[model samples]
Target: MEGRLENGQYWQGWTVEAPVGVVVFVHGVHEHGGRYAPVAARLGEAGYACYAVDHPGHGRSPGNRGNIDGMDTTVAGVAALVTMAADRHPDVPVFVYGHSLGGLVALTYLTGERHPRVVGAVISAPALDTSASNAVQRAFAPVLSRFLPDLGVLALDIEAVSRDPEVVAAYRADPLNHTGKIVARTGAEILTAATAMPARLRGLTLPLLLVHGGADRLMPVSATEVVRAHAASPDLTVRVFDGLYHEPHNEPEKAEVLTEIVAWLDAHLPPAPA
Candidate 1:
């Protein structure tokens, strides 16, 4: 569950044994991979192997709270885990399931490298861009970070800090989750990712399933809508679940959500190019 990489960075995750292809899950900011236990069990019961990794500085992964810069290191770390997973399951289709920040990290994993040769990907409310907070963060972060570099003073109030009681409750209950704290550098990278969403969408030829909650306040559906509208991938599909929040997989109808993910993964990820 916990191990240090050859590179010295500590990583944490869950591994489920199955004969079928392996599905590696990456959780978002503040949350850990354990939150995906039920989904992993569901998929495992259905015969698919699963590996869920906590991002650096998240969950049991070793690092100070909210210290991953630029997200590239996190993506590379994911590639490392995928490589290890591949060594165990040779030639099997490797699929990635990422949520919010994890989704972006998944995208980051695929963007500039060809390490794992992932078969397909599932992105739930991937925060490709920070929607509309870039302008202010870019301008004000320099001033704020000078005084309070560790104040978690990034843009976006996030739904957790809003008037929404349910969102706050769920966030508070998750011990693996962090508070409203993102470094200015991290904020800049998020902006870069959001800005590149259009180009990424055009070039992402991999089979992708983008799921977004219709009621999500933090990661608005427009991000998914735009990607679905413009993605050049012939196999891209978007699912908008009614009444779900930013995290549909962890929502009340998580069973239904996992069912849809498993079904989609089953349909797209064939055994292999035998």
Candidate 2:
């Protein structure tokens, strides 16, 4: 079904079991909810209703293409999604899963005061530390943001970095597949998350699984290393996949990662109330 949030963003999602737990997905930059269909469908097959929403200006959601504006808004959107999906499912816990930029947003949301009702979260290839994007963005950011909230720049292009050629090709072929108009402010938000990660690392309590690709060029592998180093949550687990690129869950070894995720979720989230 298609629905619009109070924030004016739209979502395309599906639910399987009535009153069963919910899983919401926040996709990374330049992509949409459609990319998560395979993963979400698998989760549904496992008895959990899954949802994937395109963030503002990305995917089917209405806005400029690839311009997320900031993490705070997207985090709010995730919280709102949990509340709304919770309304539909009611009796079960709702988990939020995010990849790349989405992972940082989920982290920020989970650590804050008004947390979502999730028993656990799965963060794949998270952007948790500084890299080349950090330096370039900070050096030339303010000037660009002032004039170009949406300037249609290519950040490595979707095709160049994906481990899955078909997924990369599908994105390039999609009518809404956008390589243009990434908001400078959105870039800034990602940096802020990268900058503040250290101080905030030890405060997380929610069950979390951080997955990263050793060969990821967009977000450094050190990103997960930093999080694992300072994490106060004893329940947190980190998995680094060899030879995988940015989106580890979509990599060739995705089945292994998915299996690990399902096991993590099963242990953390109790079976639906009988």
Measured by TM-score, the strongest candidate is 2
Instruction: For each of the candidates, give the backbone clash count.
Output: 2, 1
Candidate 2's C-alpha runs over 4 A off are: 18-20, 114-116, 134-137, 152-154, 271-274
Task: Assess candidate 1 and give its lDDT.
Answer: 0.72
1-274: candidate 1 lDDT, tens digit per residue: 5666665555544455555677888788777777677677788877776776667667767766665544677888788878877776786678888888888888777665745558788988887656456577777755654555455755344463324466567667877776756765555566667677677667777888999888887788887876787677799889999877888876777778889888998897665545
Instruction: Tell me model 2's lDDT, rounded to 2 decimals.
Output: 0.75
lDDT of 2 by residue, 100-151 (tens): 8788877777777444567778887677765556456687776675578676
TM-score of each: 0.86, 0.90
For all candidates in order, the CA lDDT equals 0.72, 0.75
